[model samples]
Target: MRIRLQRDIDRLKKQVVSLATLVEERFRLAIRAVECRDADLARKVIIGDAEIDQKEVDIEEECLKILALHQPVADHLRYIISVLKLNNDLERIGDLAVNIAQKAEVVASKLELPIPFDYVTMSQRAGEMLEESLNSLVNLDLHLAYRVCAQDDEVDFMKSAMQLQFAEEIRKAKEEHIEPLIHLFLISRHLERIADHATNIAEDVIYMITGEIHRHKGFEYHHSEE
Candidate 1:
């Protein structure tokens, strides 16, 4: 029974990791679609969302099966719980990628305007956070998990700054450019949301490993004044 339970756990980990990889690729494609204004690529990401949803459901069912059959205790139970939560986060992140892709599709249909914000940097940071969060989970590295949590603040700062910049740009933009600019701003928001989900996954990993609930700990990090 013990060996079988461990095997099931190992299979669950592989499934979750595979889902994470797919979601990350989708996210990157969404970012690229935004950068290149590729409607076809955006459409691909949007259409691929169903696959992610299915995978999430399958993982959840597997976790439930393990819980019901093996009735894992202590660390093993925590690991399964963490994977379940992480699966949801990854699925949500995939959905956010689709949202960004939809925004990109809209932007692709419109005339190009001068983008006034640093969207590339924001996207890159969010992508790194997602990748690192998954890496932390795979390696069970507490330090890496902490780093992933700390990086969320930077993405948050970028979102706030982008909002301010968009407000100013909207004031000066012609009526024709306003809608596309709004869509671009929304893409930034979606990226920020992805970072948030990544942070949640990192927190779950910490909880799984240390049995320490870090949620709502009031651990604040400083952001740039720029």
Candidate 2:
């Protein structure tokens, strides 16, 4: 029973990693679509969301099956629980990618305008956070997980600044450009949400490793660094 349980746990890890990679690719594509205002790329990201949804469902079912069949305890149980929560976060990130893609589509349909903020930089930072969070899970590195949590503050700040800039742009822009600028602002908002989900994943990794709940405490520590 022990060997079988370990095998199932290994399989679950691989599945979660696969899902993470897929979501990351979708997010990167969405960012590119926004940068280039490419409707076709945005459409591809939107279409790929269904596959992500199905994979999320499959992972959830597998986690439930392992709990029911093996009844893991201690660290093993924590690992399973962490995977379940991480799985949900990855799915939500995938959904946010689709949301950004939808915004990209809308922006692509409108006239090109100068964005008042640096969206590419914001997207890159969020993408790095997601990648590092997944790396922490793969290596079970506690420090790397903490670093991912710390980076969330930077992303949040960028989003807040972008919102202020958007408000100013909306007030000054012609009526024809207002809608596209709003969509651009929403894309930044979606990227911020992606960073948030990545932070959640990092917190779950810390929980899985030390079995300590650090969701709030981690935020406090990271916030102090700012």
Candidate 3:
């Protein structure tokens, strides 16, 4: 029974990792769609989301089967729980990528609109955080997970700065520019949400590694000004 459980857990890890890889790819494509202002590319990301949705369902079913059949104990039980938690986070991240793609679809139509925020930098930061968070999970590295959690505030700060910039831009823009500016603001919001999900995944990794409930303890490192 123990041998069978380990086999199932190993298979679960590969499956979840495959899903993560696909999600990361979609996220990168969504970012490119925004950067290149390609509506078609954005639509590709949107349409491809069905794949993610299907994978999420499949992973959930697998988790349930493992729990029912194996009744994992202690460390094994924690790992299964962590996978269940991170599976949702990964799926939500995929949805957030679709949201970004949808915004890119809108912004792509208005080529002349001047972007007021440093969205490129913000998107890059969010993407890095996401990749690193998944890395923490793959390695079950507690320190890496903590580092990813600490970086969440930086993305939050960037989003807040974007809000201020967008407010000023909206005040200055004509009626025609207002609509696309709103979409750009939403794109920034989506990126921040992705970062948030990434942080959640990292926290789950921490839980898996140490069996410690690290959420909402306010232990995350903060920037000097934050």
Candidate 4:
């Protein structure tokens, strides 16, 4: 029974990791579409969101089945529960990526604006956080999870900076750049929300490792000096 339960846990972990990979790809494509102003790629990303949603539901069903059949105890139970919660977070991240893609689609018809911030950087940071969080989960590394959580603030700061830069650009050329400015703001907002979801998953990993709740409480986000 124990071996069977472990197998089930392993299977679920694989499922979650698969979902993460798909979502990460979506995020990458969304950023690419923004950079190149590729409306078709953005549309593809939006359409792919349905796949992520379906995969999330499938993962949840697997978790439920394992819980019902195995009734895992102690750490095993905690891990399964954490995966279930993290799965939700991953799904939401996918939705945010799709939202960004939609924003890019809307702005694609207009002339591209000269913004100071790079969508690539923000998207890369979010992707790194997602990768690190999943790594922490697979390896049971609380420290790595905490580090991923800390980087969320960095992503947030970059997003805000992008927004401010876009706002300034918009004010300078209101009529000429209004469409791109609106889309840029929307895309930045989506990236911020994606970082938040990644942070939530990281916190869940930390909780899975430590057995302590850290949901609503304020946690300091540590930044590395540049």
In the range 176-200, model 2's lDDT, one tens digit per residue, is 9988888899888888889989999
lDDT of 4 by residue, 1-226 (tens): 9999999888888898899888888888888887788899999999888899999999999999999999988899998899889999889988888888888887777754554567777778877887788778778889998898777768877876886887777777758577767777877778777878878888998889889977656543433211
Per-model TM values vs. the true structure? 0.95, 0.95, 0.95, 0.89
lDDT of 2 at 121: 91
Off by over 4 Å in 4: 219-226
Candidates 2 and 4 compared by TM-score, better number: 2
Clash pairs, candidate 3, are: none
lDDT, candidate 3, 35-147, per-residue tens: 89999999999999999999999898999999999999999999999999999999999999999899999999888886789988999999999999999988888899999
Model 4, C-alpha of 114: deviation from truth (Å): 2.4
List lDDT for all candidates, in order.
Answer: 0.91, 0.90, 0.91, 0.82
Instruction: Give candidate 2 misplaced runs (Cα > 4 Å).
Output: 218-226
Q: Which pairs of residues collide in candidate 1?
A: none
**Alpha-carbon deviation at 131 in model 2, angstroms:** 0.5
Tell how far residue 37 is off in model 4, in angstroms. 1.1
Cα distance off (Å), candidate 1, residue 38: 0.3
